[model samples]
Target: MTLGFVMLVHTAFDRAEQVARHWAAAGCPVVIHVDGKVTRKVFRGFRDRFAGDPLIRFSRRVRVEWGTWSLVAATQVATERLLQTFPDVRHVYLASGSCMPLRPIPELCAYLDANPDTDFIESVTTDEATWTIDGLEAERFTLRFPFSWRKRRKLFDRYTEVQRKLGVRRKIPEAVRPHLGSQWWCLTRTTLQAILTAPDRAEIDAYFSKVWIPDESYFQSLVRNHARRIESRSLTLSKFDVQGKPHIFYDDHLQLLERSDCFVARKIWPQANGLYDTFLAADRPSRRVAEPNPGKIDRVFSRANGRRAVGRPGLYNQGRFPRQGFENGITAARYNVFCGFDDLFDGFGAWLARRIGGRVHGRLFHPDGARFAGAERVFNGCLSDNPTLRDYRPEQFLTNLLWSTRSERQTFQYHPGDTPEVVDFIARDPNATICVITGAWAVPLHLSDLSFADMRAEAARLQRADAAMTATLQSAGTAARLHHWTLADFVAQPRDRMRGIMHEITGPGPRRVTDLPPMRDLTGFPAFLEQLRNDGMKPVVMGDFTATPGGRNGR
Candidate 1:
C-alpha cells in the first residue's frame, strides 16, 4: 500500500516548495494546489521547480477565502486529481502549506499500513462540539451564509440578523448528520471514492456551499456515512487559542512540538528556521514508535489559552483591557488603608509600618501630592507624586502602586480631604483592608491656626465626605475588610483596638504588643466639639468627645 498527500498551498511559497520536495524524496506522491490568488507567473515559476519529478503534480487552481466554500472546493479538486493519477495509492493525507512533518515518513507509512482500513479524521456531532465560536453551532448548518465573514463582515452580520429576525432557516439535506472538526484529515481511498460518488453528492455540495466555514464541516459530516472505520481524531497536531485561532509554532516551540510525538504538526511560522531545520533534517535521531499523543503538550497550550483569555492579575495592557466586571483582579496584592489614624496620632504611618513590617505612605490621594514613603518624588515603576496625574485616574494610580510593590505589604493613609471617588473603588476591592477612625479629621482642623468660622465650615464638608465613604464601606455588597470606630470610642480603649489592628494586619499569631505609639493631646477636644455645635453644625459620628488621656496608657 502507498500513501499520497494533498497539500493546500496559499502563502509561504518557498517553505511549501521545500516541504513538497521533502515529501517527494520520501517515495510518496504529492499533489499541490496553489491558490488562484497567486499570479499566474508566480504559480508557473513555483510549478516549474518540481518539473523534474514525476511523483509531484499540480492541480487546478481555485480562489480560496477564509470561512467560505472556496477552501473545500480547492481540497476537492486536489484530492480527485491525486486519486485519479496515483493508481496504487490507498490512503490520502490532507495537509496545509504551513504543516511540517515531525516524524520520519517511513514511520508514518508503517503506522498507516497497520490500519489501512481506518479513517483518521475528527468527526464530532454539532451538539457535542464545544470549539465553535460566535454562537454558531447548529445554526451554522441551518443558516445560509452568502457573504464573506472576513471581507464583508458587516453585510454578513446584517444578513444573519435579518434571517434570524425573519426566521428563515435552510432545511438540512436529508440523511446528512452535520458534524464539525479540524479541516485536516487522513482518509482511505475507499472512503474518499464512496463520498465522492454518493448519490446525493450534488445536493450535499449545494447545501454545504452556503454553510459557514464549510471546509471544517463538509468532509467531516460526509465521512460519518461512507467511512467503514473512523478513529474520530486527526493524526496531525494542531491547537487553537481561546479566540479560535490556530497557535503558530515558533523557534521557541521546538521542544514543545517534539514532546507531542505526532507524525505532523500544522501552522508553523515561516521564519522559524530552528523548527524547519531540526524537523526536516534527513538523518534526524529516531524516536520510539509510540501512538501519537498530542496530550503530552496539551497542558502548555491550556496555560497559554488561559493567559490569553483571563490575563495576569492586576496587569492591564491595550490588547486585554477586559470589560467591566470581567477583570481577573482589581489589584495585585493585599494592602492596608488607614482612614483617620494619621490625624489622631503623631508619626502614625512610621509607627504602623514598623509594627506590621510593611511600607507606609501618608495621604496618597492628598490634593497637594501623593506623599510617598520617605517623601520621594518618584516611587516604584516611576510613579510620580504629581497631584494632577494621580487625580486624573486615581483608580489606576492605586492599582499601579500595589502592582509595583506587590512583593511586600503596603499601608497608606486616606482622608475625607483626599479623592472622594476612590472610596467606592477601594470598598469594592477584596484586597483592601480599611481601618476607619471616624471623626478624627476634626482633630487636625482644631489644631490648625484658623478662624473658628473657617474651621467649622471645613469640618462640615469633611464630615459629609467621610459619612458617604463610611456608608459605602458598610454597605451590604462591600468586599473589603472594614474596621470602623467612633473617635470617642477608639480613644476610650486604645490598647485593645491597636492590638486588634496589628493582629488583622499581620495575621493571627502569638506576637506580643508591648509599646504603643503616643497619641496627640486632646486637652480641649470636648469644648471644640461644643463650639462647632453652637455654631450651627452638629458634631455627629464623633460619639461624644470628652477631655481624657487615651494614648499609650489608655487612661
Candidate 2:
C-alpha cells in the first residue's frame, strides 16, 4: 500500500506551490500550517499559487511565538489538521517552507512504505543528566540582532533596543532544566493521533508548554513512551553541536548542506534567496526518496533499531556524578576540561590540565565508546547550565573550549570522534584556540594528555577557518565580540607554559572565579585520581586515570 505524505510549512515561500505539485503527482497529500500571524496578503498569495493542487491542504493559520510554546502549539495544531483532513495519511512529516527535497519522490515513498512502524524522530531524553548549551551567544540572544528597516517593527524594535541597552534573557525557570532538540519529525498516523487525543491531553500540553523547546521534545518523548518499535532517529538530517542545537547555515556550509542527503534542509535564513534558490535547483523534478542512500553522513539515515542509552552513564561512570549541560555559560571561569575521543582529543586535555591542574574527567562508555568521550565529560559536568547532545559537534565543542581558555579555569574533553572532518576542522583553527589532541599512542582514558602535534601542525589551516568564522561575527555586526586564543607558534612558547597562554588570551593578571562550587567532584583532578579506584592497586602514572576498583581487572 502506498503511504500518504503531508508536508507542513510554517511560512510562505516561492517554492511551496511547485513542491506541492510534486506531492500531488506522487499521490500524496500536503498540509501546510502557515503562521497565523502572517498577513492576509501572504495567505492569499499561498492559496492562489497552490490553488487546484490536490495534495496541498491549507490549514488554519497558527500563531508562532518566539522563545515560547507557540512552536509546539502550531505543530500540534498542524498535526491535528493533517490527521483530521486526511485520516488515512500514513506518515505525516513536519517540515519547513524553505526545505528542498533531495530524493526522488518515488524513492521517498518507497522507503516510508518499507518502514511503516518506525517513528522517525531523534528521540533523546536528558532525564537527570548534565547538559551543555552553546549559548556562547546566549548573551547575544538576550540582547538582539540588528534587522533591516523592513523588519524593524515597533514592538520588536523596542525589544531589540532593550536587548541591546539592557540584556534580557529568556526566562529559564529554576526547577525545570530542559534539554532542547530537533523540531522535525515523521510520525505514523496512529502515533500522531495518540498524542493529540491522549486521555491526559491537557496535562501533556501544559507540561510541555514549559519545556525549553516543546516542538522538538514533546512529540519525540510522547512517541517513545507510547510506541516501542521506533528507529529513534529523525528523518531530517542537519548537523548539531554538543549542545544538541541544529547547525546554522553559513557560506562554507553551502556545500556541506548539499551533501547532506536527508529529505529536507532547514533553519535557513527566511530571505536568503540565492541560497534558497540554489537548494531548489539541487534537484528540479523532485528527488524525494523514502530510504536515504548509505553514502554520506549528511543524508544517510541510520536504521539502527536502538539508541545510545540516555541516562545510563551512571551505570558506566561510577555513581551518577553531577550532570553537565550544554548551556553552561562558557564565560571566563576556571573550567575543568574533559577530553574525549581517544584519537581526537587525547593530548589537548593534558595541556589544559597543565593550566588548571592535571584533572581529567570522563564517563565509562560502551559500544559507541571513546568516540565522544570529551563531549560526555563536558555533558556530565555541565549540570543545569547547558544544552546536551550525543553527537560530537566540533563548533559547540570548540566554542566551549574558547570559553574555558578565556575563563582561566580548567575544562575537559574526553576522546571525541577522530574523524578527518574534525581534524580538518581543527586544522582550520588557530593556535590561540584549545582542543584535545589526536594520535596513535593516545590512550582512550588519557584523552586529555594525548599530543598536540597534529593540532600544532594543522594550526595554520585551523587559524584560517577561525579567522573566517570570526569574520562572520564582525560582518554580521554582533555586539558581543567572541575571542579565540589561537594555540600557534608552539615552538616559541616556553615549555609547560599555559599561564603565558592564559595571560595572552585574557589580558591582565588572572582573577580566580569569585564563584565556583565549594564542593567539587574528585573524579577530575589527575592528583585526586580516585576515578575508578576499588582494590588496593598499584597506581602508576599511565594507569592512574583508568584504575577502576580491581586494578585493570575491575574494568
Candidate 3:
C-alpha cells in the first residue's frame, strides 16, 4: 500500500528534515507545511535540504496559530497537495515534525495492507457524556474565535466572558453533528477524497473557520458524517497532561515507545538524550524471539460445548493469617499465581509455597515472546516448577473469552467450543488458590507496553476481563481463594521497605532491588487496589511480609 504523510511543522527545521528523510527512505511521499509565521531563512533551509528529492513536497505556507482554524487550513493544504502530487497514494497520515515512527515502515505498510478499508482515526460524538474536554465542546462549537487569541490572551478572555454573559452564540449548521478526537489521523484515500470533494465542503469550512480548535473537530466531524468505512482509533499515539499539552517523549519513555503498537508517536524532543538515535536505531529489525503458537491450544478446545461443569473446591491458604476457619488446613494449600511483569509476585508466591509446604503453579502471560521468556526464567527459577510462559495478547484473548460467555449471569462461564486451554486449566484446577497481580487496571502485564492513549483505551477492556473472570470463578463455586495485587502497593512503600521485600523474595544473591527495571507509573496503583477491595477481593499488600528465608524484615 502506497502511503502519503502530511507533516505540520512550525519549528525544529532540522528535525523536520530528518522526519521527511526517514519516510522518503521508506518509499513514501512526504509533504511538509511550515507555518507562515516562520522566518524566510527557515523555509529556505527546509527547501534547500529537500531540493533534489521529488517525493518530498512543501505546501503553500499558512500562518498557523494554536486554538484556531489556521491549523486546520494548513493540514488541508498539505493533504490536498499530497493527493494531487501522488495519484497512487492509498492512505494519508497526518503528523507533526516532532512525531517519530514507533514501528518499522514495512510493518506499518503490512498493517495497512491487511486493513486497507479501515480509516485509523479517533472520532467520538461530541454530544456524548464520555467525550469530555472540560466544557470545551460547548465553548468551541458555539463561540467565535476569529482572532489570534494568544496575542492578547487576557483581553480575549475578558471579551469571551462578556460575550458569554450577553448570550451570544453561533448557530451550528443543521446538517452537522460535531465530533471530536485527536487532530492526528491516518485515513483511506477514498475517505480523504470524499472529504475534500464533499458538496458542502465550502459551507462546512466556513462554519468551522470561526470555531476554536477546529483542527481537533473538523476532520472527525466530517469523517463521522460522511466516510463509508471508519475505525475510531488513531494510528498516532500521544499523551496529554491535564493542561492539554502533549507529553514530550524523552529517553525514559523509550521502553514505552518500543512496546507501543502505534505506527507513530508524537511530541518527541529531538534534542533529548539520544532520543532521535534511539528511534532511528529501532527502525531496524528487532532481535526478540517469535511469538508462541495459540493455535495449538485453540485447536484442542474448539470442540467442547458451553455447558457449565461442576468442580470440587480448591485449597487456599491465607498466608500466615489463614482466616479462622482454615487455620488447621493451611498445610494443604495449593496456589495458582497469575502476574503481569512484576517478579515480586512470583517471589511472594514461592514464599507462600514454602510457608504452607504445598505446590505452587505460576503462569506468565504477555504478548511479546521475549518478555515471556525473561519472566519464565525469573518465576520458574525462583518459585514453582517451570512456570507456564505463553505469548498471549490479553486484549484479544479476553475479548474473545467475554464474547464466548452466556451473559445471563455475571460469572466466568466459558463455552467449551470457544474456551482456550489456559481458561480450562484454571477452571479444572479445583485445589489451587488463584492470585492475580497486575501493574494496574490498565497495565495487566508488562507486555502491555503501550502508549498512554492506548493504555487508557485498554483500561476499560481490562476491567471487563477482570469482572468476567471474577464472575466465572463465582459461578463455578470453586474453593480457590482469590487474591488481587496491584503495583500501587509496591509503590506506596518506602524505598527501603521495597528493598527489604525484594531481598526477602529474591533471597540475597547477585540480583539486587536496584538492579530491577524501574516501575513506570504508579499513580493508578492505589485506585486499582481500592477497586479490588470494592469488588469484594482482599488484596494482600506486598510490603507487609515479615518472614523471609533471607531474614530481611519488611515494614
Candidate 4:
C-alpha cells in the first residue's frame, strides 16, 4: 500500500536529486525520467548522483518537445517503469523535477491510503474545462499538432489554419471522449496498469500521438474507463497564467503554497532556497486531517492573472499597450475640455477654477505654448509648455496631464484655432467633459485689429477646424459628455448655460453660482459676421443673430 513517484525531470538536476533522495529517505520508491534532449554528460552526471539509492530508477529517455507527442511519450515511459519496477506501490503519483512536497511524506501516504481506490486527477470534458489557453479547447483533441508550438510557432499556426480550412480533423476513438486537465495526477496501480495494458492501447496511443499536447489528455481521458472512483481533481497543485504558462513559485510563495494544503506543487524556481530548506526539512509538520484545497490561494493567482492580462486602467507600459478601443480607460480621471468658452467669457479659466475648485488651464494645445493656469513654463510631472513637445504626441500630453493631476478635476480650454490633434482622442475618452460654445472663435476674430481680408481668411480656416471638432463630438461613437451651445444661443441665456456646465462639472451641490463671468462686448459682433458672409466666408456655426437697437448686444 506504499506510495510511488514518477518524476518527469528535464531541468534543475540538482534540485531533482535533492527531492528524489528526500522521497527515498521517506521509504517511497521513485522512477526518474531524464529528458533525452539533455546532453549525455549532464544525464550521466545526474544519474550517478542518484545511483546509491535503491528506491530510485531511471526510465528510458524521450526527446520532449512542448505541445507534441514527445511529452506524452516521456510520461508514458516513466509511468510504465514506475508501475513495473515498484509492484508494492498502490498509488503512483506523477510529478515534475521542480515539484516540491508541501506536506510531510507520511501525511500524504496516509491520505492516499484512506482513498486507496479513489483516483485523484483533474479530468473534465472540454466544455467544462476553463483552463485551456490560446483558443484551443476541444480543438486540441480533434486537430493534429505536428509542429512544435514552442519552437515552430509560425508553422504550428499555419498548419492549424490549413487543417481548419481543409476541415482535416483527426477521428477520436469511440472509447475516448477527450478530457483535459493538469498533466500531473495521482492514480491507483489498478487503474494505471489497466491503461498501460488495455487491449486497444496501440490504437489509443496512435490516435493521441497526433493530438495536441496529448500529455494533458491521454491519462486524463483513459482514467474514466479504468478508474473505479474518480475525484476529478489533482492532488498536485499547479497553476497556469493567462497565456497557459505555468506560474513559477519563488521564495516569496512559500507561505502561499503552504496555505493551499496541496501535497505537492510544481514549477518551483530553482533559486527558491527558502522553499527547499523549509519544506524538505526533516521535521516538516504533517497535516493529515486537512483536505487538499488549492482554492485557498486561488484568489491570489486570480488577481495576478487579471493584472497580467487586463493591466491597470489608463496606464500604458511596454508590456501592455492595449489596442485602440480595448483600453480599460483612455484617460486616468475626469477632465474638462472647454472649446470656445474662453473667447465668449473673460478670464474663463480662472472663473471655472473658482466654480469647480480645480486647476484650470488655458489653451493647452495653443501653437505658441501651453498657456498653463499660472502661465508657468513647467507643470506637474515636469511637463513643458513647449509647443513642439506637446504637438509631437498631443494625446500623450493630455493623458499625462490627467494622470498627474488625478486627485483634482482638470479644466482646460481648447479652441479650434489651437492644435486640434487631441480632439478625436478627447471625444473617444469617456472621462472627458466637453463644453463647446460653437463659433465663439469668431468673437476673438471680431476683437482683433487685423485687416478685413486677413480676418476673412482666418475666419474660414477656424470655421473649418470648428466644424471638424463639432462633427467628432456629435458623432454616434463619441463617449465624452458634450454640452454644445451656438454662440448666439448661448449669449441669449449665458447665466443658465454657465450654471448647467458648472453643475455637470462639480456634480450636484448647494452652493449656486451667484454671478456669471462678464461677457465681452458684442456691439458689432453681428456686423462682423455679416461682413464675413459678404466677403463670401460664411460663419454658419454662429447661428442667426439680430442686431440690437441700443448699438450693442446687451450684457
lDDT of 4 by residue, 406-500 (tens): 99888889989888878889999889999999999998789999999999999899989989989988998899999998888888777778789
Q: Which 10 successive residues of model 4 have the least lDDT summed? A: 546-555
Model 3: lDDT equals: 0.60
The local distance difference test score of each candidate is 0.89, 0.48, 0.60, 0.87
- By TM-score, the candidates rank as 1, 4, 3, 2
lDDT per residue (tens digit) for residues 411-462 in model 3: 1212111223344345334433444433333333323566544544445445
> Which ranges in model 2 have alpha carbons more than 4 Å from their true place?
1-12, 128-132, 135-180, 240-255, 268-555
TM-score of 1: 0.93
Candidate 2 lDDT over residue span 166-261, tens digit each: 645555333223333557778888888877887777866665564444565567667765664777566666555444445555444556555656
Candidate 4 segments whose C-alpha is farther than 4 A from its true place: 127-131, 135-175, 251-255, 272-278, 281-284, 303-307, 373-382, 448-457, 530-536, 547-555
Tell me each candidate's TM-score: 0.93, 0.44, 0.52, 0.88
Error of 1 at 70 (Å): 1.5
Candidate 1's C-alpha runs over 4 A off are 127-133, 161-171, 451-454, 546-555
Whole-model alpha-carbon lDDT for candidate 1? 0.89
Model 4, residue 192: displacement in angstroms? 1.6
